[model samples]
Target: MPRSLAGFTGAGYDKGRPLLVQALWLTVSTVILGRWWCPNSVRVAMLRAFGAQIGPGVLVRHGVRIHWPWKLSIGADSWVGEDVWILNLEPVNIGANTCISQGVLLCTGSHDRRSPTFEFDNAPITVGSSVWIAARATVLRGVTIGDDATVGATALVTRDVLPGAVVLAPPSADMTSPTN
Candidate 1:
């Protein structure tokens, strides 16, 4: 499948259109697939049936939650790390040869709590080529990391990053220092 929706969000190119790239078409095949991870060909096909646009040489390891299959794109030879939550509620682009490390949360949508209706918001995420998003990094919506950038582990990215840059999200100030 090209995309799926899970964590409080939704993503895609419009609806009911032929995908430009064929990604996971080779991973598996099925009719009306369901929530799955690291499955065989038929299992992968199930995602395709759900409108996911997977690429060649991509390895989606076990237990990765891909939300919004239709709005997601993984370039060739990209490895989506294990247990990664891809919030494709908006568009998420992963360049070729990139490694999205384990437990990374790519969140592209959120609710507007301040608004009276509490409606959902959308934003697209862009990852450049040859980049390595370290484990447990949260790539929030509307972020664009240029080519060759490195996102450190456990980083919470809320802004755009320049190409070839090494970024580290500072720890939240909420944490209090331990004292004797």
Candidate 2:
């Protein structure tokens, strides 16, 4: 339910929460109803239809948001785990057979703190094939992980990682640069 803010209702966000059984049923039922319902498969299909460029048998679990479907691409046999948040304000590319763990936030947007006016920024996040992004990892914009790279749980990614490398450090935040 949306929160009542003065005379307006506000949208709620709980990206880390799993859908309860009743909530799951409600979500599936919406699929039968119409476009208002965002079933798991339906949402995936919608992403594909919007030119997400997904390969075969990709499963995007609930609570993942792809901001620009047209600019996002996922390779074959990838599993996007539960509550993984993707902000594709910029183009995002994921390689084949990759696993994106739960509660991972791939954010492509940021705000400039140096500027007097708060300006927004964004970048693409690219993950190579067979990579495992563990739970709660935050991949910032414009960072590319090479094939088979493992980003540990709760890790913050800031730079381009070499193939098969791993990092568990706080990410860098720069609001001036943005991705194409």
Candidate 3:
């Protein structure tokens, strides 16, 4: 059957907060947490104020975009790099000592292509302790990255990664070109 885009409302997806609170969070994140000059402490504090469960010594760099603070939980001593986007429509749990590099996208939301309504197929993302998701990598919904695993730059992670594993980005066409 062909896809239908009409009446594609995201039914049954919970926002996890009231409209007023969500609006307040949007305003605060844009004005303060998303700025390059915002202090890490202040940003963390703002996230906590918005209901995020951030642990001690967690470093959330500037320019980071968190869609819903209440759905996020970063363990102690973890580092969230600059410009990282956590689209956590569902819960996103990052374990302790993890490093999410710059521009990484930890997405917990996706659409059901099989459904004509294109309904939400969202699920939580779990990053085990000591994991490192490199720059610009996209971790899709329902992925559970194991402890000590390393996801290389620009990698697209759609499945679970075992502990101590390293998932590198596939070689680009330019990299395979014949050199003189």
Number of the top-ranking candidate, with lDDT as the measure: 3
* Ordered list by TM-score, greatest first: 3, 1, 2
Model 2, poorest ten-residue lDDT window? 8-17
Candidate 3 residue lDDT tens string, 21-88: 99999999998788888889999999999999999999999899999999999999999999999999
Full-model lDDT for every candidate: 0.72, 0.74, 0.96
Residue-wise C-alpha lDDT for candidate 2, range 1-180, written one tens digit per residue: 343234322122222224463354345434431343455577677666556798888888766655556677899999988778777767789999999999998987775554344445556789999999999999998899999999998998989999989876554566445857
lDDT measured at residue 120 in model 1 versus the true structure, 0 to 100: 70
lDDT of the structure predicted as candidate 3: 0.96
RMSD of 1: 8.0
The parts of candidate 2 lying over 4 Å away from their true place are 1-40, 169-180
Q: What TM-score would each prediction reach against the true structure?
A: 0.72, 0.70, 0.96
- Candidate 3 residue 171 Cα shift, in angstroms, is 0.8
Per-residue lDDT over 1-180 for candidate 1, one digit per residue giving the tens place of the 0 to 100 score = 222234323233342334433334323222223335435454345555666666677777666776656677878788887678886767788898899999999998876555444457667899988999999999988999999999999988999989989988686676556656
The regions of model 1 sitting more than 4 angstroms off are 1-44, 171-180
For model 1, where is the 10-residue window of minimal lDDT?
26-35
Q: What C-alpha lDDT, on a 0 to 100 scale, does residue 47 get in candidate 1?
A: 53
Q: Which parts of model 3 are misplaced by more than 4 Å? A: none
Q: Sum up the clashes in candidate 3.
A: 0
